[model samples]
Target: MTGQEAEELLREGALTVEGRIPDASNAVLYCSVSHQERSAHCVYKPVEGERPLWDFPDGNLARREVAAYEVSRATGWGLVPPTVLRDGPLGEGMVQLWIEPGHHSDQDDEGDGALLALVEDEEPGPGWKAVGFAQVGPGRTALLVHADDQRLRRLAVLDAVINNGDRKGGHLLTAPQSRLYAIDHGVSFHTENKLRTLLWGWAGEELPEEAVRVLRHLERDLSGDGELAVRLAELLTAPEVDAVRARVAELLRSGRHPVPSGDWPAVPWPPI
Candidate 1:
């Protein structure tokens, strides 16, 4: 079916908004049965006429985000699983797996103090590890679900190269066991545009071998009829996939170890 038909399907659901939330776009808590055999956590977005209070220009914002998440899912990366996009009674919507909030240290807060922390960069540790305040729990508190901070750190760097422009601390979630996950990727890989993000601090350094392998595979798959391109096409335009291929090629050719330089946007920026 065409995009319009798909959206029509979403609009037929018995979806309702739970409330408005800050940070994220107009997306709000919504409930509706998803699969015939199961239910899921979902969010709905309405046209501006329906939800003038919501800042998103249209349901396309939700579409952009869901597309980016699919890119990660295509790579077998666990940042976000593929989410179901559909039409709701109110408007277009999505039904996705819900993530429970992890425990936070005393510093984590949800108010203005928390938002301020995101733009305010501070060294979380030595070795160039700067963390966004979102990582800080309520009132600048830290979360206890401590996955390998280093791995998450590396993933953040890759996120930047991929031009994932929405890796805000709030988007990087961890389970109680410290399993890292990233969410909200509405703006990514715009095909030859500056897909720059908050993770630019590692621009001059050699990429981790582990990351390079992933890129290498992606590079090869882009030219063939494989899952990566098929999956990417679901979210990105044909040109966007070409752009991703170019970026991966450029990075792989550098043959350098990971390091930071002034040329990149900024290290430890909130959404790198």
Candidate 2:
């Protein structure tokens, strides 16, 4: 389905909870949303079910999730799934179109081996970029690596722009057609520098030409009185929204991907 149609179903459809997603920190409900004859699977995250984070404000993660979708939409990369914020069976929450696994699940090593790997060798080899060294077992260390694929590179840029704090490996989803989708964006759009991800392979590298062009467009769209700027003001705090613009400007000025600030851990825990 098209993004617009999926969004419409997510926003206006009747959501029937199918089950709960296991092992998630917050409540993640697997459901099917239907509007008349059209129906699709979706994930719902209610605001009331959110766990308190010392760093982020309470009860706003749902909005942030929607906000992330907005920014993703603006980028024209469609890196994030079609998402919306509306009332759900639990309460007000973030609803997103469910992405069916393509040939592999998120942790399917057989398929995603090229996208991410723990290499015995020190270097990442050709077509791969080293994230950093990781401790795999007792006294055994391996180099954490990710593919140099353009899709992940674009997502890395999006992560930087949103100040994404938790870009875990499990958060990366592959759709039926091999489309890449990044979910769990509740910790994004922070006023502070909170970018954390495994896709740091391109750190300090020059921005791709396409990414530069997209950033330029974002810089314009996020400026004063712009549609995106106005929309974000509703979903995030004024300072947080301003910080997004600042981040875009910084990316444009540097013309290179961002490096970790070293104030916090560069990669999320359980980096797989």
Candidate 3:
């Protein structure tokens, strides 16, 4: 669906709470969203239901979620699911299209196996990068891997540009056609250096040509009077928006995947 259609549905849809997603840090609900005749399965996180975080401002997570989608769309990567901020049964919140795993295509039969293998460390062979080792069972050590998909690599670049602070393995979702979607972006776009992710495989490597092209476009879009800058101003502080512009500029200048700065934890806790 087009981003505009998704946004309209999320804004005008009737949301019915199906249930709570167990173990979610915040009160995330499984919901069915309908607008007119169109309906979509969605995940909703109400602002009131958000757990207080020492770092992020209260009542702002929902906006941040929408901001992430905007940035993803601005980059033309479509890394994030369609998301919108609106009032829900629990009050104002963020609603995002739910992506189901195991969706397949005629061209790729691997389905969600590649993603699962990355998380489960079940012989995620070539085209995957092992970031660290995990204890899977008694006396058994398993490798923690990330898919080497170009789309995911672009997402890694996007994460750096946004200063994503929580990019755990669980946040990566596999959609149909083997597309990877990044979620739970409420802790992103901090002015400070707060990037934490599982995609360090391409560190210090030159960004692929397509990624560089996207960054160049993003740099232009973050400048004055650009659509991205205007939209971000509504969701983020002026200084935060400037920081995003700075990040885009930095990426365009560096032309390579960034290495960890060593100030903060390089990876989020509980990688998966």
Q: Which number leads on lDDT?
A: 2
- TM-scores of the models, in the order given: 0.65, 0.96, 0.90
Model 2's number of clashes is 0
Instruction: Tell me the tens digit of each residue's lDDT in model 1 across 82-140.
Output: 45566555545554445555522211223111211232333433333333235444566
Instruction: Count clashing residue pairs per candidate.
Output: 28, 0, 0
lDDT of 3 by residue, 52-87 (tens): 899888889888889999999998889899998889
Candidate with the larger lDDT of 1 and 3: 3
Q: Cα lDDT for residue 156, model 3?
A: 89
RMSD (CA, angstroms), candidate 2: 1.8
Q: Which segments of model 1 are wrong by more than 4 Å? A: 1-17, 32-34, 45-59, 103-128, 131-148, 192-196, 255-272
**Which has the higher lDDT value, candidate number 2 or candidate number 3?**
2
Q: How well does candidate 2 match the true structure in TM-score terms? A: 0.96
lDDT of 2 by residue, 17-131 (tens): 9999998899999999999789999999999889999999999999999999999999999999999999999999999998874533234324644577788998889988999
- Candidate 3 structure lDDT: 0.83
If the candidates were sorted by their TM-score against the true structure, best first, what order would they fall in? 2, 3, 1
- Model 3 spans with C-alpha error above 4 angstroms: 102-109, 116-125, 135-142
**lDDT of model number 2:** 0.90
lDDT (Cα) of model 1: 0.50
